[model samples]
Target chain A: MIEFRHVSKIYGKVKALDDVTFTVGAGSVTGFLGPNGAGKSTALRILVGLARPSSGSATVLGLPYAETACPGLRVGTLLDAGAQHPGRTGREVLTLGAMTLGLPRTRVGEVLDLVGLTERESRRTFGGYSLGMRQRLGIAHALLGAPEVLVLDEPANGLDPQGIRWMRRLLRDLAEAGCAVLLSSHLLHEVEQVADHIVMIGRGRVLAQGTADELSRGRGLEETFLELTAHTDRSPGATASPGAGAGRGSA
Target chain B: MTRAGHHLNDIAGAAPSPITKDEKMNADTPIPFRRLLAVEARKLVDTRSGKIIAVVMVALVVASVVARGAVVGPKLQTLVGTAGIALGTLLPVLGILTVTGEWAHRTALTTFVLEPRRHRVLAAKCLPPLLAAVALSLFAIVVAVPATAVVSEVRNMAANWEVQPLGLLGWTGGNVLVAAAGLALGALLLNAPAAIVINFSTPVLWAVVGRLGSAGAALAEWLDLNTTATPLMRGDMTWSEGARLAASVVFWIVIPMAAGLVRVLREEVT
Candidate 1:
């Protein structure tokens, strides 16, 4: 379980996360939803101990994330797909992460296979990897220790339809095994399909939180998402189109 | 209630909780520093760049020994001197490559995520190169031994090329210091090309300044990296000169290293 207790972050004069508070329960997939620059990434970083909150605290499994004895083993994260050494092969990158957690080196190959990158693991350099491939590799690295909690920021970014499907399934499996899976995405429909719970933020403040069906009411998930996060200054007038709404609900 | 039910209830109330001492021990045991360092070292060694740099250093040392022993006779000292110059130029470049490799590959995030204590990660990164520098220096001396003997036999002249163990140690120490300084600079710059350029150019610029006049020479002798490193490497300095050399290294290497470490710990990995 991950808990944010009055956590706040500021950059210069702008408040990146404004006294945010939430809980991600175990055995469930929690989707963090917000428009760009809405503190989604900042909140995720704080949860993973990459960034300290300006005020208050974040905890993973009742202990401070920063104070966790084995952060790599306890909480796996993929904050950004691009955050890897481009010169290293996929296998090498995963192995490095595994070693940090005192995990067996063989787990590197296992993750590669899990992410469906086993064939290209040795041959693909990070610099040459396509965006989708990089995302998959990043996910593989995050899964290195079989961490109890998984924190992913835009894990589906750069993935195609097939890759996205794989990702949804992967996240579900992880949550089913009692891992607290917290992922951020701009795609509400994807969240609606996969998330057991939803935490919505706008302009660095929570606007809504509940299950997908509970949050959307009887309206289409995307339409309801757009309506709930409709404040112009926060979202910049980007709303789900009718066709997108239909396609998403069917999917 | 039956006698058995009464006994079970009494047992349930009287029995201590099942929290074992082992569970408490597991919770209290923090991850060891050595384990984290070993993990960092493993990452450093596993990379292609790390392997290439090691291979290149060995190749350069062997080639220097063979070429000087086989081709150049009386100028063996000069060849050694040339090799020293080449190493001074190259070691810093390798150091920059080592430090910036994390950033260039976007692996800094992964590295720091694994070891959230950034300072520990930085220290681990420095350890491998420093050890390798000392080890390579010893290896170079050993290789030079056989090559020097072979040259003496071929030329029929007394092998006056004595290996100064202290000189080797000082030179190796100086190289490690410079390499660390380069690593720090790379961390601060966070770009491989820029860090390498600054590392190599700083000494060259000081040399140019030294050529201006007596005053410039004096200033250079006091402030210049080459002047400081030369005395330490060659064992040709008085006590006062050695102190000055030590001071110069501290100023150049220690200050930059501290600054780089600060930057690494404070700056967000983008």
Candidate 2:
């Protein structure tokens, strides 16, 4: 279970997230849809305690993630698949995660297999792995703990069609097994195919959230998504709120 | 049913899962300090930079000791002191990499996610290099013991086996302090190249400053760890020397480390 209540993040007058609120229940998949700079990553970072919220709170399993002892054991996160040390082999990355979580080293092989990485691929350093391989390694790391909650950002990036399909099934299986899954992605079709509930955000505001059919209505998912976010300013210098430049000096 | 049990009946097949009945029971338990230490220790030599620097440390220590034995004819104190000086100079670089590697390599996200009480993680990061200082000192002494004997016999010189315990302690302590200074700088800057540059260049800068006559020499005495550490390496110190050493330690190690710790604890990892 993950909850974001009125979470707002300001980075030197850039309101990355503004009064954002959402809840992800166990045994379900929530697709966090947003354009670039829509604050999806910031919100997810705040959820996992990587970034602090300027106002409001983000909690996982009834408490802030940092307060939860051994959080990696309970919540699997893949904020950046490429964030692993480049020199470490894929297996070594998983092994380190296993070691950190007090899991048996044998689990490394299992997750590698589950993510479709071969033995040779696993032994290669992460730097040499393709972007697809990096995504697989990151997925293996996230699944290393068999977490009760999963937070993945753009997990489908660099994945092939088959790999995307595999991820869809894996996520569905995890949610069916009672894991709460929060996935953020730019792929509308992938999100529609897998996510049970969709939370569409534009310009740091949640525009709409419901089941695919509920939100799509007469229009298709892509068209509905476009309509909802059509007016959002995607400019690099755009501000999220009025009077945003007022506190620029202090920010 | 256990998550692993669920996995057995799922599409993923009857593979071994990360969680089991036993693990689930202890899932919420805090990671023990020893586990963190073990992982941190492994991380020290696991990267290209960490491994290269570590290998360089060993080679330099051995080379310095053996070269000293050749030039000075196997005096235990001198050879061991050579090893100490070599380690003292290089270990700080190793320490800097160990702390900054998390940020440089972007593994801080993974590390902090796993262990969120960042102070504990920082403490764990600091210990492995210091421990290496102790372990490698023993290693240097191990090499020195045989080098002293072999060189003494080859050159037909009486071996001076006598070593001052205070000097050895001072040597080891000095290595630890300098290494801590490196760790502190790494934490303060959180950039490998930048921190390593500052670590090496600061002493040279201080050397230049110390050459500016009595005022400069006095400032170096009170503030430069390199200058204060000389008496420490030689096992010769008065109460005044000890006080001066304390002052330099505060100036070099404590203040930067405290500021670095605060920054690290409060800084966002993005």
Highest lDDT model number:
2
lDDT of 1 by residue, B1-270 (tens): 254334322322111122112222332344566766776666665667777877778789878776876766633443455456556666777677777787887777777777777888888777776776667666666776677777878888667575565667677777777677777777778799888787768767787888889988877887676677777787566797887787777777777788888888887765
Chain A agreement with the truth for model 2, given as TM-score = 0.92
Model 1 chain B is weakest, by summed lDDT over 10 consecutive residues, at B12-21
Model 2: residues >4 Å from true position, as ranges?
A236-251, B1-18, B212-214
Q: What is the lDDT of residue B138 in candidate 2?
A: 84
| lDDT score, candidate 2, position B221 | 73
Summarize candidate 1's per-residue lDDT along A107-130 as a digit string, tens digits: 666677767785655567777898
lDDT of each: 0.73, 0.85
Look at candidate 2 and tell me the lDDT of residue B40.
91
User: Can you give the DockQ of every candidate in the order shown?
Assistant: 0.25, 0.48
Give the distance in Å from residue B132's predicted Cα in candidate 2 to where it truly belongs: 0.6
TM-score for candidate 2: 0.94
Tens digit per residue, CA lDDT, model 2, A47-116 = 9998899999999999999999889878999989999888888888888888988888888888888888
Task: Report the C-alpha lDDT of model 2 over B9-116, residue by residue, as the tens digit.
Answer: 553432323365666556779998888888998887776766887888899889999999999997998899899878878888888888898898799998998888
Instruction: Name the top DockQ candidate.
Output: 2
